[model samples]
Target: MDDLLAQFVIEAAELTQQAAEDLLALDCEPGNRARLDSAFRAIHTLKGSVGLFDLAPMQGALHSAEDLLDLAIKDNVELDPTRIDPILAVLEWIDRCVQHLQRVGTLPPTAEDEGAKLVLWLASGRAVTPAPSPVAGGTLPQWAAKLFDANPAIHRNGAVALRYTPAPECFFSGDDPISLMAGVPELVFARISTRENWRDPAEFDPFRSNLIFEAISMAKRADIEAIFRLIPDQIAIAHDATTDPSELPAESHETTTRTIRVDLARIDDIVGLVGELLTAKNGMSALVTQAQLLDGGLALSRNVAALQQDIGRLVAQLQRAATDVRMVPLGDTLRRLSRLVREISGQTGKPLQLVVTGGEIEADKTIVDGLYEPLLHIIRNAVDHGIEPEEQRQIAGKPAKGTISVSARQVGHRIELAVGDDGRGIELGHIRSTALARGLISAEAAAALGESDCLELLFAPGFSTSETVSDLSGRGVGMDAVRSSVRRLGGKVTISSAVGTGTTIVLSLPTSFAMSRVILVTVAGEQYGVPMESIAETVRIPASAITQVRSNEAFALRDRTIPILRLGDIVGSGAPGRSEEMLLVLEIGASALGLVVDGIGERFETLLRPPAGLLRAVRGILGTTVLGDGRIIMVLDLEALLA
Candidate 1:
């Protein structure tokens, strides 16, 4: 296989897998002509690409499937559930063939040689199409051979698909999936989706290629053909069902519907451009308003309001587009964890199964993807350390096979994912001893720590109860990594375990990646955000109310002494700034902290990306949120700043 063709083959495998998964989803409601068309195009593209490289096996199978699908669509062929298994079997065939080719120079011997068998099986999958009678003389006519040439030069499918199936054992080797994308021959567009389910990255074996791709193109089938041709069995193809004009209403109907199917990435690009435009318009309009006041008095101000109204409309549209791009089912993440639990049960010799609930909940896709790794680590750690072995469970009078239940629910604007397992829970004593020995906590503190306080130490670095290390799950042995990942992703993870019962790991993640209603406060001359969530209320307390208790400054309210952390004192003001009347009363956990600040400011929303380089070194700043007015406000790292 030539380099380009080989690459295409590799890409096609992934895209095809993705295409299959997506199509299967639209199996019901065959009325979704748009979806059906998209699925068909993916398969058709694959078949066309196979022909380019003279890949007989893959091309043959895909061509057969595409023809059946095409026929079905023209006459409303059912996306019968029974067809899914066989189709997946075909995809598996493609995967196996691709793996073999990647390892060796040649295609391995298989059913590909049995063309009669493939035709027989494919024919059975569809409505009975009359087979032409066999010719008496079994010789191809010269003219017929020329007519039936593999490279017919007709690109039937206008769109493409990219598929990925993380190997069942992919979790054993860590492979950070960027997505199911491939540089294929005649590419129109590509999407990345998973097959089966996701395994924990720690368990995903990188050595194995579990991801598959399906690309669509009518220009050339060369790229995918070379890579996928060798391993024909592991890949499958069909024509794009979406582009079939025979199905959709004419172009005239486009304007009547308020919504149109759009690629998410395109929407993301539009959101960014619109955001920049919104910012530029804001600055320009402000300048114009100022100029009008100086030059023409009230003339430009009249038009300025109109411009601002236009900007608001644009901003609203931008948000709708972005949200559409970011929205994804919570099930995507939960399904992955469910798969991980099954793998863990097998790996740890613990008889456990995951019972998943409420997966249909929706959340931002960015948060969902970032969450996969952290959730995986916590669950695996629970199995490895939180759960007892089958023998131990039996001795405890519990069922030999344990159960881990994962659930997701949308409460207000945030989504919560809980992983609960019925197994041996943590021993706080072990944690206390471990924390003290490791010097993470002093012996005095360990002795005074309550069970809940000591148990939290497990989230600290190097705090694991596993006596012996196994190779199945990695660095997650120290759950501090999980904590860090969660914090970085704008989420939090907490564990509650009852001795001799079970453990539940709950992760709270935001539904919005970036918001527009952030209230800003200044701490020690520097600005910060209290996440509106952790804010109870900001009150200006009398300076005389502040009193010292046990050498720590405090304020008493409602018979409660809340710890006072002068924002200027803890965050230093170049020099001890003047004491202020207002205190930012923030509640975290079970305690309250009063942070004195130089001033309180207006509230606005902005996109907050992680600080880079020097800014990251600054303490107590989770991230910086940009305001529509162009000011950047640092977000107070609540845990570090207050805890």
Candidate 2:
């Protein structure tokens, strides 16, 4: 029973997301009848499922929403923005109810009142009468008729005719057909017979199941469906059969398949084990290297190296398998933002259109979950601050409706997501003056700042150009939070804008948080890792190749001047290496930087573990990893270090 409840929660959450997506699509493309039907089915399924549990409030709310959608479908009623909010409200309330049920196995006390209000609000807009109950005492089948006649006084409000044929190997799969049929609520009659003729006793196979179970129940259709939801393919249901039982359709032969809903803790445990496996594999490789250095261990090293290579391959495969389980499509996350855009646009009285692309790209679930708030902040900022009013847009020779596009794509081993708007771009002069007036930057410094530098000030704490605080902007906390959250996930966010064109904010994040491929390098005689996604190229430079640009050390690479930083000096390890040094060129947004390191090592995938205690507060380091030879290496935060 507990397992069933857990599965219900997972399915309900998925259905809620689907329903939300359909609702948003329906709003955008009102003529899309298929979307309307899909949304209605999702709500109807949710209502039936919730009815099986003790969640009456959820059932009631969903029932009303379903009825409202039915009216839209049957009567072709056009749903305006005002009518859409109540339906969305019902979804939001359902989400809350699901959360409460997950935590306490029951709905909250206030759910009843809140649900009543939502139902009332929905019903006030459309004339929705409750569906009539199934007709009482419908015609029974020949097999059930005899049993009913024998009793005569047994009153049944509804009749469910079920034909269940257990699979031949169902016994091995932990199925007890008789026990399942016995648990049916209000069971009035049942007959069990063999699907196939019985064989001779000597040839009989007790392990195989060939039973055909037929039953009649007075329970509601929803209740009956719930009882057999897990194995629907094995059963055929006829509700309040106003016809002969023989007229029922054959049971679906398709096998019932399901996804296992493992606890998140269990997945985390598996990830942790994979991390340890990777560490151990690397340790074995290190030992093989050490063995090869010994005089008489060469032969042994060769054999061990072969074994180590095989193990490494297996570990890599395991890592990928584990990560894939956590990957979710970006569409799920973006669908949520659609609702926010609608609400904010309505509140600000600004007409806006949201366009999304590359939503099929997949990323780690953890990263996708963390993105909700930061993306919300960015989208809100775009609608409220970036987009110009309709009149202003038309006067500027632009369309009356503003467009905000959110897109995602896989960039090598990283995920690049951008939220942009075709609206009046940021005003650099206004930002410079605001920064100077707010004391965020000195007047002299503000005057000398470039466009990119001026844009950076937007992320500064409490830096906003708005003269007054409103519901959306002026608190001056949105961008800063976005930067903080992105950085915490080992990613970077950058903003680019043109004077009158538009603005785009891009986020580059690792494809997964559990593991990453990094290039190992030695800085100040200590080993460190730089994410491979950030590395552009590696070159060995002579001492004479270095140039001094004002007070900064830089060099020309591919006709572009790139700044150089000594890794030893930045981490306080030691002085730069010899006259000839290995330089790692890193791409950070639109700029490139060269890091002078003592030596560059091989690149390999490794698990990233979070820092603890004081290490968490440290900058320039994303996390730590255990190397093959048991050496602990710090993963450098290239973006933060350069910032």
Query: Which number leads on lDDT?
Result: 2
TM-score for each candidate, following the candidate numbering: 0.58, 0.61
* Tens digit of per-residue lDDT, candidate 2, span 1-643: 2544665677787787688888898788877888888989998998877876888878888998898788889998665545666787677667656644654466655677677777887777542332111111123445456545544565543566666778898888888888888878888777788978999999999999989887777775456666776665576554433443232212110111234556777887788789989889878876787898999989989989899889988988888899888887777688678788888899889998889887778888878888888898888788777898899988999888888899998998889999999888999999999998989889899998888878988887777766667688655566878987887777889999986678999988887886678989988668889888788999998978999888788988889888999888888887744788789999865568998998889898888877767888898887788777777889998777876
Candidate 2: where is the Cα deviation over 4 Å?
1-263, 290-302, 357-360, 397-399, 410-413, 427-471, 478-481, 492-501
lDDT of 1 by residue, 1-643 (tens): 4444555556666557666765667665545666666667887777666665655776676776677667768988666555554454455455444544543434445435433344555667542223211111112223223322332453443332323334545444453333223435555544444554667898875455555443445432233434444343344333333334332222112211222445766766766666565556656556666867776657667777677778768786776667757777777677667567777777888888778887777777777788888778877877777678888888999988888878888877788888888888877888888888878899898998887667678777776666667655555446778777777667777778898898888888787665544567776557777566667778887777888788777888778888877766666663353454677778754357777776788765555555667889986677665555677667777666654
Best by TM-score: 2
Report per-prediction Cα RMSD to one decimal.
19.0, 13.9
Query: Model 1: number of clashes?
Result: 57
Error of 1 at 306 (Å): 7.2
- Candidate 1, TM-score vs. the true structure? 0.58
